[model samples]
Target chain A: MMNRDELRTALIEEITRVAPDLSADEITEEASLRDDYDLDSMDSFNLASAIHKRLGVNIPETDFARLQSLAQLMTYLEKHPA
Target chain B: MSDFLMPSLGADMDEAVLVEWQVKAGDAVHRGDVIAVVETAKGAIEVEVFEEGVVEELYVPVDTTVPVGSPIARLATQASVTPASHTPAEPEAAPNASVEADWQPEPSARPALEVSARTEKNDRISQTPTTPPERLKASPLARQRAARTGQSLADVTGSGPQGAILAGDLTSAAPQAPAAAEPKGKKSHAGFNPAEMRKAIAAAMARSKREIPHYYLATAVDMLTATHWLEAYNADQPPEKRLLMSALIFKAVAKVLRDFPEMNGYFQEGTYQPSPSVNLGIAINLRSAGLITPALMDADKLDLAQLMTNLQDLTRRARQGGLRSSEMTRGTITITALGERGVDSVYGVIYPPQVAILGFGKVSSRPWAIGDALAARPVMQATLAADHRVSDGHRGGLFLDRINQTLQDPEQLNQPAHQESES
Candidate 1:
């Protein structure tokens, strides 16, 4: 099982990688996905696709927007372990 | 002594009205401190002090619509010196103009100082021109990659004759763009136009191809179970709350990254800097602009409802060209889906920092042996492009296996009872 902190950190690292402009400090639990990061619909799909390929978990669109922060994402993943 | 000029805040506003002054004559002010409030087309914004010194004079009155580049205030050093003559110079110049004039010293002395500075700056510029070596021309993308990484043209050994830079030169050089160009959205380039956005895609992809050491792996998985699960779930949910295949893929990817931490970091400073959160970036294909990858922060944390909302919001904004700078940064991995348009399999290029990229291709019906009879099933092909520097082909294959395993088992992805009850 993936630890919460490790999962959070991995997510942040991937975010910084794909979006080179964002720093780790900027990604917080309260950060809004669309408002803070400017991710568009297609970008979100691409993000999901990338994660699916790398991490092996499927994130349903029904759960996409609800994930606002690293902490929140961890809870969702724990409930729906791949 | 120097004059502080009111900066042109925007292109539309020709003049700014001074709202208030936060400093007074003789008061010590530091650079970056709020010195005054100026009203522009957008709204009132605080202007910061650009230099540290005592406030010597206030040139513009509050509420005055001062033209852009006009001096709003003056700063004085501890040593007393006569204020240089303004002499109807450029209208309303910054205090720096006077300092520049005073510092000119004499015409005879100016040449020696200028010559030295010029030589130093020229030396640096000559070291790295925009042009790439001969072989790099073969791949326009390679030349662009060299330019973006700020590799000293002189330092890169060209495989082609005439000591020209090549696509191979990028192997040893760092993948950082030269500081010479301001980051995205700050300035327009001759070759790349921000208005079209394709320039960004081309630049990023070129850089990724040239700089990232990529190793690709592919996997084909049965999508029938997941497809059935999604259809059943959507039937009971509202249209707005319906889950998308992309979201499901993202959730699975996020979970897997936790197990293989190496893929979720950037190779920097001779080491991989692991990130603290999982912010996924999605690649969007804008018809006019080739492609743009905007980020979704903390994809693992959102519920189905929130995911749908966020996805909808991001897509809406992306189509309208409303993305911000922050959205473009810090993605650990990338996922691309060809949806109905893609072929059965695709091997993506590895996006830097993050060691891998996943490509999801179109789902198709294929024959499979179930017991003794032949069965046709709908399946999708997934490809992984990983950075060879961090992960080998074996590990990359294993990562794909994990994703395929999760995707094949649809019942395991049932929404939690608590989550269902809350909804």
Candidate 2:
């Protein structure tokens, strides 16, 4: 199980992997990376899949849109640790 | 000995810079092996060699710009006696009635002679070049497999011909085939410039509107039953294996397209030629920057799950690069879905040469008439922008209606589509 700090690092890495254009260090805690960077539904799905593969958390398709920011993702990951 | 020439990925491509070689001189290669990766305006396309042979010599080195039809490599095939066998007269491929019209010369496309002349003019572009140390010796499938997983290649041993790592070896690279195929080391290649992409899009779209006379049509499909079917179907499946509402829509479109052949083919050389099979192109937008449509081969033949998987793979590759030449060039027809983000419906511009473009808007629960009383049902807006040269409103109308009717009985589409889709 990853600690909160480890979770943050892992989450950012997965996000960066899904959208390789972005630098992992620049992903802010509260920024809605989804809206800010124009990551579409497909992008959201890829991000969710990446997180699932890397961290073992399967984000349901219905909840794909709601995953807006890195902070929100962290909270969800902490709540449902693999 | 035969020459492997650079294929024109699309109409806009006049020349491309050879990015890297997946093969080397004196190396043996099979037909369908990726010999090189060429950087076009469409991005890096892993060009496949179509004949089995030993690599005699690689003429164009990496980073050299070469015209279409220029021989990049010389292959001593089964017919060739020696590496010095006289160069055979370049064969002319007749536009086949069965497959692949995307790379074939359309009305505005240049003739073979001109392409050959251009190839000769660019001969000076190549400098003293050799296969780089960074080039991987693995098969195309194996390289793709390696890239997708971010699995380190340092430890994997090659066991195939010339010790090339095969796809089977990567299976032990566990938790493989993850849906996110956004490959590692993506930073090595320069990103597709948004400005250049916009310019390319502008050229294609402008040419489409100016050359082809287009007819537009729209209909609202009550996806109530389809949505329900998808929900119930996905409930039992794993997250990665689940199907989306778009999959149902795509299946419906591909299935329905078969019934209206004129609406599912290319309008090239002042004539409309219906494709023998359905290569349903999906217009995928890259951020807000630009668009690329990579087709799913035999879309109608794929069941719901298969269709969904293919779509996912196609979009992932489209957004991240690694789109093959055939995938980028061929589009017997295209479907653009803009509904998810915000739009109620999209009336897309017909991607040139291909006679039709289907658009779907967001499926929303709206009040609809069921015999007498109005009930809340999921309704999706569907629009068709088709070539006036090939199909009129009558056939186009019937096509959209068939999609509506097909979605009403999603179970029929779920069955294994063993029946051939008549183009």
Candidate 3:
């Protein structure tokens, strides 16, 4: 199972890769992904691919659709703990 | 009369549901006319008539599903009719007759025919109990080549002993020669690849940015009224029938597009070619496949219930990679919403030939000036990308204005309250 802190760090790192202008400080555990960082659909897809490659976790399309904020995504990752 | 077998829609489709019967028994169906609607993994697709004739039989009923390649209906020709004896053994006769006809070619035309005949005679002798061939059998290459081409081993000629077939003889005797002109060094660069997907994105985005001059217009619409309306509506609705904000947006978009037909077209051949019907393509992200845009046909004609059904069907098939070729084709406009994804604003690229693409961002709590006071309200962001070639900036602005107006007022959307309640 992935640890919460590690998962959060990985998520931040992945997000930063797509949006190079975005910094790690911009994304927090509880912050809204869309409001805090302008991650659109393509960015979300890229992040999902990055997570799959790094964490070996399969996020189904439905789950990806439901993920809204950093907190929600973290909770989802835990439930589907990889 | 000859039976007309169902044409395979594609290599992937295994079975198709007979959604509707376009021609009843005894009705004449012309070639290329839609005879029935088949519901495959893709969507409800219309099957066209291949042969023109009177519909003699309805083997499959409406809503009844049949396997692909199975005869769903039969056509009557001028030929004499035979009793319905569609047995497993029937298919064999057709293939055998064709095979026999295929074999009746001029002997002199084929140089290796005499050698093949001699080899077959030798093989028959060697197989007999009285005598055995000195050699163990055929070469590995010859056997592999024969298997690959579906050629009979006995039919191959031999350059060897008392007429023993060798690999070279078999290769020469092969009726169809593999094309040597085909460039073997070059790899197959066709079909779907990652580079292609990226290129498609690049092309679409480039076209959207350059030709379809887009103007960004953001509006803060109060969802509280819509929220209250939804809550009251959902209380009476079954859990399954409950309307999502996405559905409301879809209905609003449909209604708005009906008013402005120009927005429901593509900029083709230096002119705006408006479509007769409104087919909306929704972009869905799949895990395995990067992203897919599956279309919902006749969105303007569908009721709320039918729209919901179509949405569910499109999304389901999209994820399964079972979308039909037609579903991805002929989309007049596109609507993409990151409703639950929680994005505040997204500037979407116009899907080509399409005049506009509507993008919906997530609803979030933001401070708003309500009358004279500041208040926190749930508001969403919408961006419309319009084809500058067909529509001017003023017309695009007007279209967006209509969409915003419709979405803000829930009562306007729920015009037929009686119909909603009955459902």
Candidate 4:
């Protein structure tokens, strides 16, 4: 029942929660999480965990590459809404 | 009553400034309670008590720099036995942080990092001790700033908790001081001052090189089976549940240490004392501070999942400066993995008291042969730097071989480790 923008906002909030050192503005929609924000494996894991916990969507390891960027992740989430 | 001494964090650490007392008199402290926070060359570390008892007296006041093994506090225990017993208590099976989520910061739960800026205005600055070897309660950043500006930390009054000088305190203390115009040679990298940290590291490494007679060993571990097993295991799970290469490496190193006890303990005073449990010292580097080797208690016993969780928790806490005294001091053996950063191999200097250090390089695809057929396989070079006084190159080579053999069978690692009783 959540909109795309709402999901994105929720995702950013979760990222901010896990990594307080990062600001919302720095997390771009199109840019890769690793290249833009230096999101390491642990950071990415925490982000995926937040998304899964919030959206109730089980993002498998194989699909991690698809969720590299915020836009890509949003698209994936929208295609398979929880 | 047993005296809780200021533990020696490392060989280079001669003394540490007691930052704040987490426990006061009459407080019933558990075996693993963080009694106080002490500031060393590596930064502020939470000191944990080993005995279950009530705190009798805080012998050393806050902000006092005391020597190693010097009693900082006295604990009233049930029985006055094992006077020199600083060994950590047996850890709980699974460290369920959720069960104790709402636990207050009274040193009972895991000692977390004191990163939150305390705005409590210090009223006891007026009672600053006017001693000769003048010690100041200042943050590492503040100390670096003072050194750079050529201003002494003692002159600036602190606004932080218990009158500890924060970086913000320095700016307000002397805004237009003559020192700012002429900067000292103290270097800083990306807002992180590493000059003092670098010096500390140098001293530790120097002492390690001087005292410990080291023997080197390296082996190319074929991690193809392990890598494939991990991939298959991780493919079905979420990102959070996925196992890291280091986790497997840690398990392998720990499991192998059981057979080769000589390489898994403290070497001191012309004698080597082997520890009953394998508490692996994981060397973690901090941006603000230097290197710290905190233990992942009973590493040989933990499964891959538990090891992963513990590793994640330990690394996170260590970087945040939330390390317990037991974790900081009770390392049976040390492991340094630089594979993630693209390093092919690492020859680490052994953290003294500990006999061996295991280093793992990057896992890369290389031409591997099975009898006659050649195929590309993921290969990793694991190096072992051991104290020659306790172990020779033959034993060191065998230890590396055991690690390689253990890693070959990933299913063995994933299996529920048999419950081993601690001595």
Candidate 5:
């Protein structure tokens, strides 16, 4: 199991993989990936799947919309322990 | 037995430099093998061979700039057909890294951008050559860097095979050039120069508008049924397997194209040739480079899931510079969809040799009329920019409307598409 710091790093990696134009320096923990970074619907879906593949977490459609921010995504991952 | 020539990437390209050889002499290769990587104005493209054979000889050395259709290699397809093809079949003797790099096209030939004339266009580039023009041997990389750093090739001495100039030669000769001053990481981040790419795109668009008489049409599609269907369809699927709404749009357009053959093929030399298959050129935006619209070949044939997989694979490979020659050139028509983050509607300029281009904009919540009452619903704006010589506004309108109608029956999209007019 990855610790808190490692989990945050993994999530950011997934985000950048989808949105190559985005950088780690500009991303804030509480900011929305779509609202802040301009990731489209397909990009968002790809990010979700990429995260699922990397961390072994299955994100449901209802919960995907809720986990828009890094903090929310990390917290959900920690709770689920996937 | 046969000479494998350098292929022209598309109407946008003139020539390419052999970047590297993936297969050497004596190597057995099958059809669709990526035997070489060549760099064009649009970064490196993996060159795939169509014939199954043994590599008999490597003619062009790595880093040598060869014209489109120039013989780059010799393949032994049949043992009896090789006429004095005796080159010892030795891989080590073949030009690897240190070949004559100073292969440059004559100044006049380099500037011959003959994309405007209507007669014998793309075929002219591939057919019989009128004596390979006198060339000043210089690697394309060195030439581009030389132009960037204001270093003239005439002044530089070549150390490569046959005294041809190479990229390494430029840095050592002109230590003060900006190409040397830049940090290592920054150079890669600055992918194939965007300024040059912009120039190429601008020229193509300008020529397309100048030469092709275009008629435009747009329609607003209500996605209440389609979006709901997509949502329901994806509800049971995992994240990896879930399909994008655009994939459905691709499948729908491909299906509707069968009924409207006029809007689904190429137009050149005062003739409209409707292709036997629907090769939808999809515009994929690259983070490093500008944009490339390679074909999602035979988009009309694949089911939703297979189409989704190909689209995703094409997108990934396109970004990574792993595209084939046919995908780069043989697109019957093009579809440009501005993703969810883009504007409400898009009107595209038709890619040349192709008669029509379809554009899709972001799906937004708009006031839609249901019976006498009006309510907000998910709506997408679809537009068509087609050649006036080939298709009329009436045909274009029906084409757009069919796409909208096809989306209303999303379940039908999951089933196999009946192959149409093209063989």
Candidate 6:
């Protein structure tokens, strides 16, 4: 089982690891990772790898399409526990 | 005894400053052991010694700039009697293995003899020689590992002689969590000046355009089938495991390269040598300035999933300035994709020695004609820039057509690849 704050912190850490250009504060919960960080598909894939490495969850490609923001990723992680 | 010469990293590289020695006198080193670190136009490269032996003497000291192919150190090779008798504990089979090794002349062997007018002449006109600067004593591999882990060497206390940094020092210096958080600020300490990188790129591209007789070709490919296949394939998987359009493109290019060997190797000294393996050079743009195209080794043999993983790793390492000496030089054919940036098409200049470069544009929907009907379909432009000396327009066109055909049947990309990809 996962909580909201834990998931958010993990996602933020993963994002920061993949795209060092973006700060933790800049990656708002509501803003899309692509829009805010210029996270193209490659960057998105890297983020996914980071998440998999950290949380031990394989985020499906379909689920990736739905995850536009940090909030969505956090929610998805909460629902699909590692 | 054999001379360990300074290796020429690329056609554009003429000289490099010997940064530090990873090995010392009386150190028992193997064939592939990294003996020294040298700072080239590209960056810090841990130069490997190809011959197994003990160091007899280091001809040139650290912080001295030397010409390419100049003898940097002398190795008392196993071929010699005294060294072989002295190193009796070493694996006997390892010494004799070179006798059974492939007869093909090593490209790096005798760099002085192999220096051609094209590259050596290019180096004279374009090379910007820099005086050796005082650098932190660390192996190139250590530096790369440090960068990858988001740990900086600035604060780490070295364990090697004279407090020289080593890879082992990085792990204990900083814990992973807090160090990862501070990745951004520490990257600037890499000491990579964007201006120097720009000049290096300029020299390489200038030499490429001037020396290599390049012919360009482009084909508009329909991506509807591949798109649908990707969607269906990824529907069941998590976001982390999804396949992108670029991965498909890379797979297609790698597969097509197998059929057309002429477009997949280095053209050195007016001779076109075909490589047995398809080591795809992926052009990754650094955030600072210019780009570094590191090879995705044995790409043709990797399945689609493996390709994605390797590409991600290669790009991450490239951007971070953590590439190794071999990855920086061993590219057969290059693939440059501008699709993610929404560019319509990219016509790239062929990196010298490599005969060809494959380019991919953005994947977007456009009205396309199919027989008697017209429909809005996903289309992307694939471009090829090839050396005219090795391949004609027909061969280049066929290569592009093969890639398009492969992508049309994207299912093959996921299939188990041929086991043997090497010569």
Q: How many residue pairs clash (N, CA or C atoms closer than 3 angstroms) in each of the candidate models, in the order given? A: 71, 1, 3, 0, 6, 7
- Candidate 6, residues B116-230, lDDT tens digits: the string is 2212212222134233223444433345556577665555655443444544355445446332333432231222324445676777788788878999999999999999999
Cα lDDT over the full model 5: 0.70
Sort by TM-score, top down from the best: 2, 5, 4, 6, 3, 1
Check candidate 2 and list the clashing pairs: B339-B362
Question: Lowest summed lDDT over 10 consecutive residues: which window, candidate 2 chain B?
Answer: B85-94
For candidate 3 chain B, the 10 contiguous residues with the lowest summed lDDT are: B86-95
**DockQ for all candidate structures vs. native:** 0.03, 0.21, 0.03, 0.24, 0.25, 0.40
Residue B395 of model 3 has an lDDT of: 78
lDDT, candidate 4, B56-173, per-residue tens: 8887776566766566676777675442354432221111212211111122322222232222223324445444223345554565566667777667666544455655456555
Give the DockQ-based CAPRI class for model 1: incorrect
Model 2 per-residue lDDT tens digits across residues B1-423: 666667767545556677678789999987557777776555567786655678887877665777776667777777633322221211111122122222221223233332222232223222443242233344334444566676544346543433444333454443456323334343333234344456667877888888888889999998878888877786665567777777888888888887788987777667777876778889887653367788897898897888988888887777656777667666688899998777898998887778899999998989999999999988899999899899899989988888889889999888875653333
The residue-by-residue lDDT of candidate 4 on A1-38, one tens digit each, is 67899978988888655543354655789987766655
Q: In model 4, what is the error at residue B384, expressed in angstroms? A: 1.2
| Model 4 misplaced stretches (Cα beyond 4 Å) | A1-39, A65-80, B60-67, B83-195, B287-289, B419-423
lDDT, candidates in the order shown: 0.56, 0.68, 0.57, 0.69, 0.70, 0.68
TM-score per candidate:
0.47, 0.76, 0.49, 0.74, 0.75, 0.72
Rank order by DockQ, top first?
Answer: 6, 5, 4, 2, 3, 1
TM-score for chain A, candidates 1 onward in order: 0.81, 0.88, 0.89, 0.90, 0.94, 0.92
Worst 10 residues of 6 chain B by lDDT: B87-96
Q: In model 2, which runs have C-alpha deviations exceeding 4 angstroms?
A: A63-65, B77-190, B417-423
Residue B385 of model 4, lDDT score: 95
Candidate 5, residues B1-423, lDDT tens digits: the string is 667767667665556767568899999977668888776655567787766689988987775777665667777675443322221111110112122111111112222222222221122222332332233344434555665687766666554434445455666667687443543321221123344455667766777888789999999999888889888887898898988898999999988887888987777656777777788899876533467788898888888898998998777666545677768776778898884656788889988778899999988899989999999999999999999999899988989999989988898888854433233
DockQ of 4: 0.24
Model 3 lDDT, residue A36, Cα: 60
By summed lDDT, which 10 consecutive residues of candidate 1 chain B come out lowest? B109-118
Candidate 1, B117-136: lDDT as tens digits = 11211222224444443322
Question: In model 4, what lDDT does residue B345 have?
Answer: 96
